[model samples]
Target: MVSPERHAALQQAWARLLDGYRVTAAAAYPVFDLLASAYSAPDRHYHNLEHLAEMFRVAARLTAITDDPAPVQLAIWFHDAVYDPRAADNEERSAELAATLLGPLGVPRDALDRVGRLIRATAHLTDDRPPPDRDTMILLDADLAILGAAPERYARYAGAIRAEYAWVPEAEYRAGRAAVLKRFLARPRLFWTDLAHQEGDVPARANLTAELAGLRGGEPAA
Candidate 1:
């Protein structure tokens, strides 16, 4: 969870972003409250406002590289907006929620489409991928940044993800989680952006390797 001051700062940041789109504070505050409520839901062990804040930091670092940063920022706000630990279509539903909410809030159709694609890209599936887009690359990199976090934080992330899937039996959860991690590990690269690649690539691989071992009830890979 974020500190009270940081949470206030995040609110101010959201207000400012909405103001840029010419959304009046009256209209913006309600939407902000809705998003806050969705993210702060009791079922969430991860994928909350804190997660958004962390991705915001990564977006800041990536702003210089993307042709357009606004849609990327919008995606960050709404990507996990409809997370359901048991659902296969969280990304699709989140994109729909974003369109349902953002359309009347002044986001243009084209930008909304771009934002939807960016949000969907978080599924980490390469098949049926969005067109080659720098913004998509940046957003995907930011979403996976937690993978490269220091060991303790990475362990916490793993535990929290498991908590989010707490209903799953240990044996089944381990198999499913291992498959996801293995797919990432099999890839030639973990992060697409040069900045994220430099900062996260090696460590992300190591962390994924370690977590895969722990999932199998063994020590993290050396």
Candidate 2:
């Protein structure tokens, strides 16, 4: 559960973003409640309200790069709002949820579409995924900022993710995780933005490499 202070701060951030888009407080509260419920769902481990809070903290450092930062903020709130480790269409489903929820709250169709695309971009499936626009890149970078976290925090993030997928068999999880790590390592740049690269690339790479080695060495899964 998020602390009262953290929850208040998140509420303020949500209000600020909504006010920027001309959404009224009356409309925003119910929407915030819906989002809070989604992120606080029992099955969520790493992709919870805490992760959203962390992304907001990261987003604050680099808001200037985006053409319009508000939609990116909205995308951050909804990107993993529907996360289910066993589901293949989590991103799409999350995007649709954003559209369904945000459309009537006075968010424009263009903004909704942008948010959907930004959320979908978090899939990290392949190297050939669509090249991100400035705002999309900002949202994507914030979503991945955990990889660049301090060592202890990064380990916690790794463990949380493992917990989320605890249903998978140990060997199968290790193989899948190794493949994901290899894909990140193979990327010419793990983070597209200079700020993100400087802030997270080295530590993220080190974390990935160490975790990959552990997987290969038969270390028990978290």
Candidate 3:
């Protein structure tokens, strides 16, 4: 569970974002509650409120790049709000959930559209979609910032991810998880933004290589 101060900070961030669009406190509390409950579910390990807090910390570094950070911030909030390890459409559904809930709260249409698109981009799928714009790249970078966290923190992240997939057998989980890590390693660049690249790429590659070795050599996961 999060500390009272941490919870209040998260709520305050949400309130500040919505207030720019003229959303009142009364109308905003319910949506915040919904997100809190969703992220706090027992099944979530890596994709929980802690991850949101981590992303928020990363977002703090690069706010100046975007003309309007509201939609980018919105995408960060809802990107994994619907995560289910077994589901293939988590990003799609999360985007829809953002639209459905925020539409009624009066986020502008263009902003809502950009938020939806930003959330979907987090999938990192290799479809033929056009390249992401700058703000979308910022959202994507923040979403993936955990990859380059300190070695100890990355180990905890790996362990938490393993915990989330505990339903699968150990062998199956290792194979699947290894494949995902390898895919990241295979990418031309793990992070898109210059600051993110500088901050995370080398460490992320090292983390992935080490984790892959652990998985392949029968070392304990995380």
Taken over the whole model, the C-alpha lDDT of each candidate is 0.85, 0.85, 0.89
TM-score of each: 0.94, 0.95, 0.96
Select the stronger candidate by TM-score from 1 and 3: 3
Which candidate number has the best lDDT?
3
Which ten-residue region of model 3 has the weakest summed lDDT?
126-135
Candidate 3, superposed: residue stretches over 4 Å from native: 127-130
Q: How many clashes (backbone N, Cα, C below 3 Å) per candidate? A: 0, 0, 0
| Model 1 per-residue lDDT at 17 | 86
- In model 1, pairs of residues that clash are none
Candidate 1 lDDT by residue in tens digits, 145-167: 99998998888888888889889
Q: Write model 3 residue lDDT over 1-222, tens digit each, in one string.
A: 578899999999899989999999889989999999999999888898889988988887777777888888899999999999999999999999999999999988888899999899989885233345878778878888998989999999999999999899999989999999988898888777789989899999999999999999998898
Steric clash pairs (candidate 3): none
Of the two candidates 1 and 2, the one with more favorable lDDT, higher being better, is 1
How much is 62 displaced in model 2, in angstroms?
Answer: 1.6
